[model samples]
Target: LIISSDSRIPSCGNSTLTGLDGDFVRRSKWTQLIPNTTEATAAAEAAGSSRAAGFMRLTSHRVTIQGANSATLQVNSGQMKMGMTYGFHLQVFNIYRGSNVGNSKETFLVSVKTEPVIAQIRGGDDRLLPIGSLTESKILIDASLSTDPANSTAKLNYNWLLSLSSGPTINTSSLQSLATEQMFFTTVPFLYLNKSSLISDSVYHLFLNVTSRRRGGKAVSSTSQVLRTTSTAVPVVSVLGGGIVNEAIPITLTLSTSSPSPTATYLWECTSQNLILTDPTTRSTSLDSQNLQILPSVLNGGATYTFQASVTIGGATGSASTTVIVNAGPVSGSCGGSPEVGEGLKTYFLLGCTGWSDQDTPMLFKFSTFSPTSTLELSSYSQLSSITTLLPARPSNTTIISSIQDSLGATSSFMFSLQVSQPDTFDVQDTRDLIKIRLTEGDSSLASVLISGTASYVFSNRSIQNTSQQASTVSGLVSLVDSLLNSSVSTTEAQVSTPLSLLQTVTSGPVSSLTTSTQGAVLSIVERTINSSLNSFSNAVASSTLGVLGNVL
Candidate 1:
């Protein structure tokens, strides 16, 4: 009998084998008849052999398909490799081998070929590369064709094909691009040995093809998954950690985790065109000494600024970010100053006019502490008690007369000093009253002139000095000038007017701005009285300098 086999059945589908005996089988058998005992033994043997042959033919089919399809898969590894293979084998058993359509003694053939794998799956940006290998299965031929009889034609002539375990699996999406301050990593699963298989010694090589593309670009790297069978668990790494320390402001940062852990290192990277130092390791962060200091230039109008900081550990890196703000100092100028004693000490000296001017007199600067109480607290030295004008020595009140006669008569150019008895009365006076002086048109108290309190020192009776000789000379010059201007000389002028010898010139002549000059002379005399009695005044709770001013004025 001749028998043939078909290999069209799918590896995972139901397939059967049938046997056909021709007329040649009957003719050959008729001539080969033998004794009943021998024939019976041969029949039984043929029956057993036919059953075994049928069993082998029906069970020889093998099939294999990928766990994951041509779609992109994710795997974790360092490199890629190809030409490596891995597969899974499926064992089949004949369920209808005892059917009667054909004898059990049948021979069969089996084969397998690759099915066209569809296009690969689309991978997204930020996806990591996959690592591992591919697997292929093809039918194996007659074991019986071998030299060894132990494995006969009946044993190998079935539909059996060589089987392979599945290949390693990998990640096919969320690919990450390599950029400055960035890192990448991934996870992968590969084929594991099935200890339950009949052949325990079989090993499969895994191969893969890797193609990388930057965002919106074509593949830049393509390769196969390298063998990592001996390696321990591999983990995918990503370059995502960064940090910043803003010295201007307090340091603060936020950390993100790929997975939770008791402790994890975050990586951060920073780039500055100018570098103070470079650390070969931990490219995640580069800190310059300059960055540590908060520079005014980095700030806007001395306002706050911000940046980032990177963190790392033994080898792994993680990142956290924070912001910095800068602070500015105070502005400077000549604000003001403090006070001196009776003689006013020059206080705040404002330059450039400061939008104010000396009205008819020098600007009367007021002096006080941070706070002031009435005129007692604030005092002025250059008149201008109230008027806000910038004119100097403006007359507050003026008295005019066609003629005047008194015990001390007046002349065309009159110069005299009067002494007051109670000089101490000015002590404890308000700043407004400290330098007050009343100018009388003549020796009589009735006719008078009023000037700014600022220039009152010029007429202050307390400042008079008793030097009649100087007064006489001034009186002589005035009389001589009058005599030269007018030839008429009256003998009564001497008697009606005060004696020239009794008056005194308290101030030197030829002084600029008679108002200020006169005040200065008076102030000098008053300061002399205070200085002379400094010790005596300190000793006595109350002492009167009235005698000094009364005698001079």
Candidate 2:
């Protein structure tokens, strides 16, 4: 009897079990046989019961088939044994009893490794920071949350894999030859990313493979179905959660960014003196500071109030303004727009509560609460206002909970579903027009530039030894010249060359065409090319991709 999903072993399709009295049938004399659901439904129908019985079925029979075939069962980490390998070994064949193994075909035996431990990654929501020069550029990935069911104290090696495409699934077959020690992590790992480096608004990824040290360091379990990073450039902010608030209904306005910068302090301010501001003080540091509770006690009809949010991240400081209408009425909400978005694409959502009436929700309106883990890359946000969210890379049906309340503490929340469509195979293009190199407002001294971003390593002896230890004066001078020539690249630039080729090999067409590299390199080139005309950079930032690099030009 094959209970497909819970079946421990592969089915052999042996017909003898159905005809002869097997141990299972003989033990119970087939007396307590669990009825097949179809027969039970028929009996119920004949008995005049109206219930359809639905998809649930009750059966004692087991299913047996040749080799490992998963019809609907998705094997997760919890079900498998610790050390045993579990996967289809179709080539191996032998006689078996009731789907139980009888013998092994040594010649056909192939090694299969399942996840040794449950790998889980936790930090917080999709970050509000992209890679830049600062302590906030990296985030700590907590693999300690990962569990090794057999031995908790065992030493596990971590290999953090970085990618631009967010699969959150295991697909190393497409990536190149696994690289060297640079990526292997240990204990808590910190991953850094630069979204500005990409030609488009591509999200970065960081996931680790938890390997057992005692088990030859083979990757048994990997952190999958999760994309934890985001590409929210700092200094950009949007306001949300407020529409028309009456004295009874309070409109809570929140300022949010794509990537929230921990170091960046934000100041949220309102210009309207008519409305009473709750906690009138400015918000600068914490998430709570980004939220403002306003009592539209003064608004009789509708008053348009302007709010400003300013942030200083790294060496960049920017401020944005938005306006909300305050009136005495009920809050209206609509799952804003673009009910569908391709996974991993960054989308801007309109304010959840639009005007005084219904129908003002946005992409932010379509949210899904995926369980067990936030592995699907759903950006965490409330449905109140304009928001920048990185759409999940994995295709899934999302549930967006949208609601709004006015000053009277009246709350209105409705849940809707958003469909995240499977991503199309990307058409690679060079979008340098979207890229701009605004050097952080800091010292860009030559030495500081070379020494800070990365480290340079050289043997001390290699530099002076060749000259001073040389046999003759001529050789020493020659060695000194040779050493100077060898020192062409700064200390940190030494390790930079290898990853270029490695990265290019693993990336896609335009990326493989050196577009990503060119994009980064050309930023400097473009900066230098247009150094005199700072306005060109602004013009480029304003450019749209109509198949011409007009902005770049």
Report the alpha-carbon TM-score of model 1 versus the true structure.
Answer: 0.16
Q: Which regions of candidate 1 are displaced past 4 Å?
A: 1-263, 266-270, 274-306, 311-316, 320-553
lDDT of each candidate versus the true structure: 0.23, 0.36
lDDT of 1 by residue, 1-553 (tens): 1111211112333343212212112100111112234543444354476544332322211122222222111122211122122111122222233432222222122111111111111111111211121121211111111111111121111111112233443222211111111112111111222222212222222222222322233222111211122122122223221122222232222343333345444333232223222443312222521123232133322232223333333444333222222222212211211111112111121111112211011123222111010011122222221211111111121111111111111111111111112222222123222212211112111000111121233334432423443243333333332222122122222221111111122222323323433344444434533444222342111122232233234
List ranges where model 2 is wrong by over 4 Å: 1-116, 132-142, 166-181, 184-200, 213-219, 224-553
lDDT of 2: 0.36
**Candidate 1 residue-wise lDDT at 30:** 14
Cα RMSDs, all models: 51.6, 32.0
Number of the predicted model whose lDDT against the real structure is largest:
2
- How well is each residue in 81-109 modelled by candidate 2, as lDDT tens digits? 33342222122222244543333211111
lDDT of 2 at 413: 50
* TM-score of predicted structure 2: 0.21
For model 1, where is the 10-residue window of minimal lDDT?
368-377
